[model samples]
Target chain A: MYSFTKPKKKQFFKEDTKLWLVFYAISVFLYVSFALFLLVKAYFYSKNNQIYNQNIITLNTKISSLTLQKENIKLQKTIYEDIMVKNSLIKDSIKNLLDLIPDPITLNKFLLKKDSLIIYGITPTKDVYNLLMLPPLESIFTKTDTTFYQMPNGWYKFKSINKLKGNNETAFN
Target chain B: MKLPSIKIKLPKLKIYGIDVIKNALFFAFYISMTLFIIAFIIAPSVKIFKNAKNSYFLSKQEFDNTKQNYRHILEQLTKLQNQNQQILNAFKRNFNENNFKLFAKDYMNIIKITKQKTIPYKNQFAKTSYIITAQIKSPKNFYDFINNIKNYKNIIRVYFPIDFEKSNKEINLTFKIETYRLLTAKAEEKAH
Candidate 1:
């Protein structure tokens, strides 16, 4: 008891106490609201993650499928170009063979097979066919056989067969 | 042993209608509530946020990588098709005898083109063989015809059993040609 102060009753909830209570309420509200905000953000993040995962799987599958298709097209192109090259080689080979014929010995009828060539033509003499046509045929083929028949006009009709052994050489291209 | 006791008096505040004694209890209640919420709700919420963030980052990385891979494959496929445009078109082209004859009219005279049979090739293509017999003035026509096959609409291949017989003045050429083309489907949609 103070001599100069008036007698007063003590109040449990003073102005300062109420103010402190309000502060505490505000602090708790802020803490709880922040937690709730974090929870909502977490939920959205999880949802977005799930969507991204699905997209990733779909994209990977598509990528793999496209890769396979690319390989297939490459294979097709390889085969197609290979055929074209082979066709060109065959053409060149036939052209070279036709250009091998000499003028003096006429190639009346010729048979060009896959592995062999049969030439039937007329020559003034057997010696002319042997000297002009037989040497080149022997050079190009693995084997050559020529049969000459004496014609009524004193000329010779010759049949020559040239074959490629094992069909391994590029002779027929 | 017995210890001597000392009496000590602590001041107590007295109020009329306010229970000042219970203030300590309320203060403790506020502190306890705060602790409880922090332990039960806020902690778990923070944990959920952290876990979800981590998962999202991982998935995002994977998604980005997959997207890049898809783009790369698509680019490669388009480039491959563009590089082999002629080959692709030739594979898909159908064989037309009349059109081919007209195209070959400059090279040689096509006597006949009889389609022999159809067979499967490479599991995705069909190969049809044809017996072609024609007359040419010289072997140069045959050479030009074969050379021009590369530029033809359909892919053609010359097979074996090719014969060249001299007929009177003109030369007779008999040969087999195979045309290769795509099967039915499975390459159109994804390629585009």
Candidate 2:
């Protein structure tokens, strides 16, 4: 019955509380800084969006004004072309009238009015009158009146009054 | 080296229930604070960052579109200016007064060449209208005269009538032609 008792060892909990606390503080700080950075980025993006919206508005206004000007120019060009076309028609009509005159006959006095023509001319013979009253000339006039006088100089003097027909309805407004 | 020393031992300290609860409550508060940061602050901040990135891209795209539209409009304006210049040039070429006079001289020469006698007549001029009057001999010569006048590029209107004299083969033809001429800058301003 000889029993020997051993000395008791000290009991202690092994924990690095200071290191843990420091780590947690650093983590929270990092989260907060990252959140603040995100907020700043959001603000910057919103500002950029506002600037871009303003630019778009300015551009739209400019585009609209320019479009209006372009349309105005195009309208002016159309009017010019219409005037040229009408002038060309009138010139062609005058040319056709000139071509309708018979050869070998001399013209003394020719008068053109608003919608009619008056001609006083001498022909060597009366047969030239038939030529003047022919198809092309007939088609151009709605009415024609002719009077012939025998001259002492062995020539026939004739006076012709002609009224021009209206142009086709579809040709112009 | 001598006899064994006897040591007196102290009693172990007991942890009370309230102290344990206090420690547990502290740990829970720390954990809850971390959770609160993660759930409220950090999570929402991440969402804000994502939204900001998306907005930045959208804004950039819109800016690019606006820039392109602006460039296109500028190009169109340049094209319009060129067209305006062309219209002005064409107007100058077709409506010059000196050119109209030259055309009239050429027309008179053509009448003479066609064996027609031309009566001297005065020309009437206005802001936008010109009239030249002449007399010729034969109907054929008048026809030729009209045809030759048609070759002139600037004539706008022509009116001619021939009357034949009973005494001879000669005819008196009166030609009234209309044309345009470019106005002076001052005149143009006045007209407008």
Candidate 3:
């Protein structure tokens, strides 16, 4: 009797197994190194952030102090200027009154109190006394009262009280 | 004649111990080279770069803050200067001695217009006030003089005392006039 036999095929192992192992080892090494590097970088970043925060705080304080100083300076300057302006106005008012006095009048006593003016002097004639009641003088005072007496020496003694008006009243008030 | 074919058999190959050790040593060398590059070169370089970046940002922020502060100070300075200028202008528009003298001269002119003769006797200046005494020919001339001076500017108040002497056909009048000026530095010093 003849017997039939089947043919057997040869088996082969995968190629480059050693090379793959080396590649895996190198990859693991690189990964660990990168992770450590990241950790170190994070630490440095945190330290730097803290330093910067401190610097900013210091700068802010300095700026606030400077602002306060500026405000103080402004206030002082304003006060000084106000005083000077008021003084000037008062001086001008005085000059205005002095300009209005007419010649040929002799003043014996002159007194200024608040918004009132008092004058005591001698007038040669009644006409000179009448002239005191007109125009520029009239405009300067709100009210005026005059008292005159004829002396034995033929001279007239006069006293006048005038109330200051307008600018003078407002300025003193 | 047909000859019988003979089958040939090959010898089996075997792995040696030295070859295994050699492969292991090669793998170790490769790992060491990778470690050296990562620890000594790449890692340190990365750390240095990170440090440089952090410092750059910090300095940049500081610069910006300083610039802002500088601008704020400059603005304050400008405001102060403007206020000072305004004060100066106000001072210029106000009181001066020259103006006072001019006002007095104008008053004398008004007296001349009234056809009166006045002889100025004494002029006394005080810190805050001025007093002028004059002798007039007649009471009428004195009254006209008073009327003219009433509207003078800058007179906070005025004081005049009238005294008269009788001469034949003529009345002689003497008057004292007081006026004020703005307070000055010299006046303040004297007060102190």
Candidate 4:
């Protein structure tokens, strides 16, 4: 049922049409691939951002607490230094009080309290204690009383009680 | 390999000795398709991609700065702790009565140490005291004891009601020794 012509293969599409379609498909593929790559990169970046934000919050909390701890250390140092200074003052007061005793009086015992001091001593005469020891005690204490007992020997035994009222005790001094 | 050759037959009719109408229609189609693809797909995608890149860089820089700040704070904290290491350690130590007696052995003879009531001090510390009766040869011993306390292992405050009584040749020294310890809620929990 054919004429005397060479038989040709069936053509589904023209050559130029196929070429144009391939070009368009490549362009679309390249665009889609690039867009997808960018989206994946953006997703990763956002994830990293969230992680870093969380880390920042935790670090900030730690930093604040560390600062508080530093302040606390400073407070401890202040307390320590104050206590040391108070201790030195106590020592100085005790030294000064001990140095107050004169040669005429022989101290038997002395009770040093926060607000009061009581001294028991032997004096060569009542006048010796009254002249030397009584004046200093009277100067330091708010109230002072002296009781005398004559010893077997003419030497007098005197008990002096010194009292400090209110907060004017001047501490141990 | 030999490729198959294909062809499409077009209308033979022409005007003005050329296929100007068909060529113009083809050119118009290509131009419109190019403009449509660029505007609707590629341009929008590119813009979004650029914005994402910018955001990523911004977040990265912010993270770097925050990390630097954290490191700086950490370093400062370490330095402070190191500088006050002795005082901080002393606050944490518990007062040992036997150790204290041994420490005071050089200064005086400790006859007795009676424990007193414990009280809270400064909200974060516990103050416990002992009424101590000791014997010393002279006032110099008491002076030395007070001075050397600065080098002791525990933090202590010598309080009031100190008495010095001369009994025979020896002097009886009675005083209150206050020892402070860190008693924070965290430390209390650790104790339990």
Best by DockQ: 1
Per-candidate count of clashing residue pairs (backbone under 3 Å): 0, 7, 45, 0
**Reference-based TM-score of each model:** 0.76, 0.57, 0.41, 0.74
Q: Estimate how well candidate 1 is docked, as a DockQ score.
A: 0.52
DockQ score, prediction 2? 0.29
- State the lDDT of candidate 2 residue by residue for A66-132, as single tens digits: 8776765565445445445554554455456566678867666656655777767778888767665
Local accuracy of candidate 4 as per-residue lDDT tens digits, B1-192: 989988876665557765655555556876787788778876787787677667767767777887787788778878878987888888888888899999999999999999998899999999898999999998789999999998898889887878887877889889998988888833866888
lDDT of 1 at A159: 90
lDDT of 3 by residue, A134-155 (tens): 3565676787888888988777
Order of quality (TM-score): 1, 4, 2, 3
The candidates, ranked best first by DockQ, are 1, 4, 2, 3
Best by lDDT: 1
lDDT of 4 by residue, A1-173 (tens): 97899888878965655666687678668767876776777777677777877877887787788778878888998999999998998888777777888998888777767788788888999888889888888888889999999999999988898888776556474
Which CAPRI level is candidate 1?
medium
Each prediction's interface RMSD?
2.6, 6.0, 10.4, 3.1
Q: lDDT (0-100) at residue A63 of candidate 3?
A: 71
Candidate 1, residues B22-133, lDDT tens digits: the string is 5665678779888998999899999999999999999999899888878888999999999989888888878999998998889778999999999999888989999998
Clash pairs, candidate 1, are none
The total of clashing pairs for model 4 equals: 0
Clashes of 3: 45
Q: In TM-score terms, which candidate is top?
A: 1
